[model samples]
Target chain A: MTDHIHDEHCDHEHEAGINWQLVQGWVQTGILIIMGLYFIDLALPGGQLGNYINVDNFGWLTWVGAAIFLSMGIINAADLLRTRPEEHHHDHSHEHDHEHASAGSLSSWIFLGIATIPLIFGLGVPSKPLSADAISGDLSTNVSTINFGTSQSSIDIPSEQRNILDWIKAFSQSSDLREFEGQAVDVIGFVYKDAQLRGTDDFMVVRFTMSCCVADARPFGLVVDFPTGQEFSQDTWIQVKGHIEIRSIDGIDTPVILADSVEVTSQPEQPYLYF
Target chain B: MEFDLTIFATRFLGIFIEATPFLLLGTLASGLIEAFVNKDDIARMVPHNPVLATIMGGMLGFMFPVCECGVVPVTRRLYKKGLPLSTGIAFLLAAPVMNPVVVASTYAAFGAGPVLYGRYIMTALVAIGVGLIFTVQNRPQRILRPQAIFVPITGGSEAVMPAESERMELLPGIKKALLLAHEEFFEMGRYLIFGSLLAAAMGTLALDKEIETLASNPVNSVFVMQASAFILSVCSTVDAFLALAFANTFTTGSILSFLVFGPMVDIKSTMMFLGVFKRRVVFYLIALPFLLTALLSIAINLNIRL
Candidate 1:
């Protein structure tokens, strides 16, 4: 594959025609630059990056990636300008006996196309956070057993200030579910109804807890027992003003929110809770 | 379930963005090794005995901290630098999980517990065991692809260039390194992209429900977690936290298997492995680690409790 590096005929003049190898190299360089810029855009605050990943964990790494891409693109651009003929000559090995080099270049072009897949998806598709549709049966309603690092008890935080994750963490840390009973709760999360809660007046108010990105996202939420819970469709973001109540779920006594009001709300700017 | 383009795109890009940096890092490391590190240095560093060398290879990740995404290109580069096949294979398998970054991450997720210790130990055993298999049945021509098989400069092959004659000064070497990095980024990045796409497409499927159903069965859970690890292809650095989500549900042994086997061979790493090793070797690479991890984990599941 690297036989062209030792080619003695590297200084030969090129014919007056379209240089497909040069074009492919230029396109690869352009894609690299675009990818660099795309990563930079993802790193920027208030960008769509949070929709795809928990930027809090990987935000700085994204910047480092941008720098690497930009440097690689620059090096590629430099290689194009200085050694254009020498690099391009190997692609036309049909005239010579460098069949291996020609095959290598052909495979390189295929690889170049493969490298462009991310660019097409990143730019062409509109970014959106993973919703209830992204959740399979891996959803976690029993958060008591999950060890999300050191849990900061949300029990101390003023009732309305705690989010779904904080409440879940607090529950995980506490032994008694009854302690959370009657705690005023105002949390916003997307609706998710399990098959078991299909006909019941209860549905999970869930937020995906992501330590890395959406690929590692696992839904965690508290069950909201509301008379009109059936009205809220799955993946619809909603704010439920309610009070906590310990209820028998399956065979375990779990903390279930008894909602006084459920109002539809827009998805949060950062939809996922960072673990 | 109906396919959602937006969700698919989001998941695809998510894996892409998360994995690409490590791929870039791998290429950069590969370039640096190609430019600066010589064949003699690699030969001198590796022990002469195959067993010790394989064990040393497993421990080499401490010196080089890289995830599975970064390990492939570096391993290929080392092979090019005339690193022994057994050592290279061991490094390739163990480095992803044995590194300090992964150790810290696993510790953060599970603490100084059996999962943390079991993960590293199982990875070492499996990696060394596989490396030993290569040691017994060593054949570079058959195991590695034509390009990946190392040809010594002393072989006097006409197509090969002498190392001392064409070796560049420091500045030119740095420039050459950057150029090689640029070339390698595209070469390895293609596999990373392809694997990420496959993983993302699979992510949109309801495979989780099927897998979760078998979580309670000690025997099946090990296979299920390993299968999940292969399909998900989550980076080893943060995969501990991902495994944590299943800590309460999956058996301890199965979680350890996921931690050990996932980093050694996944969809993306398997694609990268295909780039370096021949098709048959790639199958052995996947199957060896898969079976080794599964057996060890199941033994723990059935016999001992974590």
Candidate 2:
């Protein structure tokens, strides 16, 4: 009776013993679900996706991607659940080669660790928009040829309207802004002072223009002059209403806004201007 | 050197968020190609004439329109289905930047500039040139890994039963594709994560001091931008924007080289290549693109105004 009981015990172990393959599959699937949720969270209201991308345009793509991840996660989870421990031992590749490396090996665990760390940190951390350090961090503060809708392109708005992007684009393309030199201008951007440009009172009101994401964001701004007594903190978002005046700096004609009033407003609803 | 951990972390997350969705979509497309498409039918459609086959492969992006990350797995699948080595290589090199969406985006970014025409013409030249070189070898057995070997890597493996796969209903077939895609994503995503972190670290270290010096030398600038493209591993769909920042500082030749070469090879894509190709082949894949792009770019610098 003891010998028969031992055989039954062996049978039970074979059927129910932890299948490392299934475990690894579940781990991967679990991460996928986490990632899917992470993206959904980003795509949702008050999420960081808007900070990086134009939510109005690319939000649908994010949802579709999340669905794919979730579906894959579900399918993998189902497969792992249905897989018998014996079948894990009996898959053709394993049966054919006893040397077949199981997914539960030390290296597999290491791989899993590396793969999930980024997602964990990514979701865990607070989102911060790209700032002045990103721009000054580049090679010398030299003129970079402007390309519209690219990561490095300064945020430019080409329309006559008060939008910063179109205004910068128009300003960059035109050698002389004599036509709009005295035009009344209203714009909003963060404070970035280029040390090389004119005096202590001269600072730029800049915004970064992004194409796909923040990885491609480039700072574009127009030079502004505040009255001698007023100084704005670095990276402070402000609304400036002024009139354009032509100033020659570095042998190039630049548009300088003579500010009538500068308000230190809170951050805008949309942090980045998308192409 | 004090590492700006916040900048590193933010850049890391930025690149990760940008590229992951595309990678997932690529894997799903890869799974679809594997589960539903008949190998024999694919083999039949790809022409037997070596040169023509390669040109067709370069243009294959027009139909598939997958990005660099997606194309890696799809090309591996096609190679397994007995697609000619030349054609497969051609398709692999050309598919990322040559497609409609990418071209349209490039046009939108730069307007009607030389960058647009130059990118298309040069990508074709490089893809065709690379494909022709592979035609001489014509041996997937020597080049690709065993898993990548879809045919009898030697001759003993049983041929895939196309008829059985054809009979498989759409729902079951799609389910199979999903499973395959899941497996592939798990396999490939490991490499992508590592590459992304490396890029993030590179971005944070403030390495442009070195890149700035190289920007002036006609020949060295091309090499610098190529190295930057390889290191940054920014997706082709958006690399133009990154390259644009360098436009005034760096030569147009260098920017064009960056635009064309980045989609074909990068640190991240190099990692992905290991999943589908042999070490020797991956080595060649990297070295050949670098050499060809450098030579072509240098020539453009010397002859063309850019």
Candidate 3:
């Protein structure tokens, strides 16, 4: 008799607790939003985010964005389509809350749109490269020929001599560092020695660190055959005293640094190189 | 028309593949917790002390370690079981930011130094702070509704018939977990792709140069980076790369803000929050983290010499 009573009570509770409509509504709405965003992107031609959309550098990302935008829009639209608006039998207590929500949606949309404007504009522009002089630090005066620090170059060099030395030669012509010959300037960086080129005392390399992204990181190695070539290792951070000079390596005139002294200091707490 | 047709078909296929894994993992963790942990468990754990509850909620990220996508469904289940709104909210916030996987990835990206340690400490503090703030102001009962649970059983016509009690056993529970994980992965993955695409497009179109100009003003720069982090949609794993790319472009404060804030809140994460919490609750969760992140970023940048 007790078991029967418990079973009957549980059934009543279960029946009263089910809110199928809300769950179904969520599923429907989610589908609608996802679909809508994608369809709109397709129909609108280039997504019309002029000054808002970019795809030039990282083309792999375009497919990813299209997926997310379309999915959310479709889901929202689906929810609206399936659920017939049910008239709420407003309990006197909840009526105030409903009225507030009705008033708030408009403001919410406006806020969302306004917030997205700068975001759109930021995405639509091309990136500006940090100029060569900025990283090498005003080599226009006091340095004979500035070394190409950790920055990347697009110049074409000979196939046989296709390394940093070759890169420096090609980069030098464009930046016109040859004109700055006979001037002295202070250069800061860590020391590395390339084994391939350095015969007992041949080359010393310097690396620059970029805090977040490495693509823009420039490596400016100063080729100094100073007597103390054996002192530095692969990543030993150091500041060397050197002046830029033109030297012949592999039949090409390359800008090399002749070191006056090499000082090994404690790795500065922040090792990143910045302009 | 030819271009559109090819692009549409390619995009559809890409979305399906990307969303599957995350969804699977999210569902697996969410389902198991749902099946075993109940309201009494939460009520007993909390209510005794808010401090203890906050610690417990924050630490739960280690045990379950659900991604942002799976967090909501698991969180929704907890709400149904009567966990406090603040505790559930805290769990949602902490799980994604400081989970084992995310932590490991962060350590790998920044190295296990102040960047890693600071991120862990700050993320926990921020999550707990937000949770407590909400708890003091609002009642969990008012905002959370009971979540619906769907269970399917086989019958005589169904090729696989099962006893009623056996149907509710742990295997079905595992199946539910897997399913939820897959769905959540797909959802979050889709958003992540969208963000990266938008970021890349902006990179190519013209905004890349504009971002550099904005970096001139220290304060406005922070705001721009935080906003870009959300719009870019890069995953936490690779976001460090994107942040590094802009090293020359933005101020240190802005770069820090972009790295810290992007993982915590984004458009997809916001939508996921809406799916779980009430609109009001979602509003606070979405708005508060972004504001807090922006403020914290500026403070860190201003004070620290580095």
Candidate 4:
């Protein structure tokens, strides 16, 4: 009985031993909490907020997830302190080496360092929305591919609400875009240079679209024929007042908005279109 | 490769932030199973008939609803609890995309298009096919590493001390789950970071004018999207939205390939596979899905209405 009790006490001590695993665990917890707080702490939903998630409705889900990490960290920290260090659960082989996995081990440190990189950068770096440069980037090259109609959204309304996304959706569902030709649209997006619409003042007005998060965001838009397309700088937010017309771009009859009026505007609170 | 810092950081955090919740949910579920469910019960529950067990495993996500990032650890916990190799593998592959959340999301993104139905059918086929491949084997001992083997639980509830009685020790049992969850999260999260890094690198650098150029051809388009799917590592919960974005540019079949094959095999989950299976087995696991998804998707791409 005495031997068993002593063994239990030793086990408690071992668990409580301060080591690299416990430290890493606390750090992991901190990383999760900080990432969560970064989103929750925003005063106005900014580009960084959109960088991680798309819908505000499900924003609270992120907080719950971060709280799990925080609580788990506290639990590990509590365990480290409560048990007073006789021998760690994994450190039974030698007279030395105290750790949850292995204290001061090379792999342990490497994993810890790798785990900490994101936390370091995530906190230090300021978040920017995917810019016009995104088009040249790998993921955004196919800017016209994203389809954005929620079946619940009625595109057949008297005035089609073809924000860059709505245009893609209507363009995608129809074999011939004649139905949409001459339809007036009030579309807002950033000016992006398109290879196909090279000259003659044809630049795309695009809004990047996201489903679950921004990593998956893809630029979705239609070519806007502004007489001064060459003058407006790439990535300048602009509102195009126009009517949709089917124009042949690189073979296919694609929708292009003939802008009657163009006005410069600041980027909106929610820059990316969400589903 | 010179990574644009902003692009890389945005994508890295994006994948991590998006996947973290599902991963947490998976670990918590794993903890609950580890704490409450006995090893024998899992063994007993998994049907013995190879085909039935494979189908059952593939369909397990109807109840579990874990994301691809999170399902690995849950499957690992189940594997450690004596779940048949066939069932565990099928569940691991199928649950991420096959669950109702994936279904609703896929439907929402594709609007009942072939991509939606194709995503379901292809995921099931790949999952059940992989599961059945393991059925001929003698309990996969050679494939699994020593660390992954099922070990008898020695501690009481795995979270609390053995001296505590099982009936009255609910909090400690839960504490045990949290403790185990933290440990599991650390173990699995390391791989997740590596996967996300590779994915971010690929997302930032690899996609370019060549992909857009090749996307004009049906065959090349399918291959490009499949490769992109493997590289992107977007969570299954929202990949359909990503695929929907590709709908107009790529064939329905190619978009379907992206939707079906991505969650099944990707950089992030592929890295995690090394933690669970032997090096050679991981290669085979990857190649099988890659080949099958490619062949079936290409076939659909060729035959389906363009």
lDDT score at residue A150, model 2, on the 0-100 scale: 39
Cα RMSD for candidate 4?
A: 5.2
Model 1 spans with C-alpha error above 4 angstroms: A1-16, A84-108, A138-141, A145-158, A227-231, B154-170, B204-213, B304-306
Ranking by DockQ: 1, 4, 2, 3
Runs off by more than 4 Å, candidate 4: A1-29, A32-36, A42-47, A87-101, A137-154, A157-161, A174-182, A242-254, B110-117, B153-168, B204-221, B245-253, B298-306
For candidate 4, what is the total of clashing residue pairs?
Answer: 11
Report the C-alpha lDDT of model 4 over B1-306, residue by residue, as the tens digit: 345787678778777777776777778888877777777678688887879988999999997888888888888878877878888888988888979988988887767766678889999998899888988886567877554567555654244434212322578767778877776776778888888888877663245666767766778888889888888788788887677555666777777778877888889898887778889988888888878888888888678564
- Provide the TM-score for each candidate, comma-separated: 0.90, 0.86, 0.49, 0.84
Report the number of the highest-DockQ candidate.
1
Q: Across residues B170-281, which tens digit of lDDT does each residue of candidate 3 receive?
A: 7555443433333343334444344334433332112344555787577888898888776544445445545644555567667667766776676556655655556787
What's the lDDT for residue A235 in model 1?
89
Displacement of residue A230 (Cα, Å) in model 1 is 4.3
Top candidate on TM-score is 1
- List the candidate 2 regions with Cα displacement exceeding 4 Å: A1-16, A54-57, A88-101, A137-160, A195-199, A228-231, B111-113, B153-167, B204-217, B241-250, B304-306
Q: Please, what are the lDDT tens digits per residue for candidate 1 over residues B6-111?
A: 8899899988898888888888898788778887788789999999999998888998888899999899888878888999999999999888889888988888
TM-score of 4: 0.84
**Model 1 lDDT vs. the true structure?**
0.81
Tell me the native contact fraction for each prediction.
0.61, 0.40, 0.00, 0.60
lDDT of each: 0.81, 0.73, 0.48, 0.71
Report how far residue A179 has shifted in candidate 2, in Å. Answer: 3.3
DockQ of each: 0.47, 0.34, 0.03, 0.41
**DockQ (C-alpha) of model 2?**
0.34
Q: Model 1, chain B: what is the TM-score?
A: 0.94
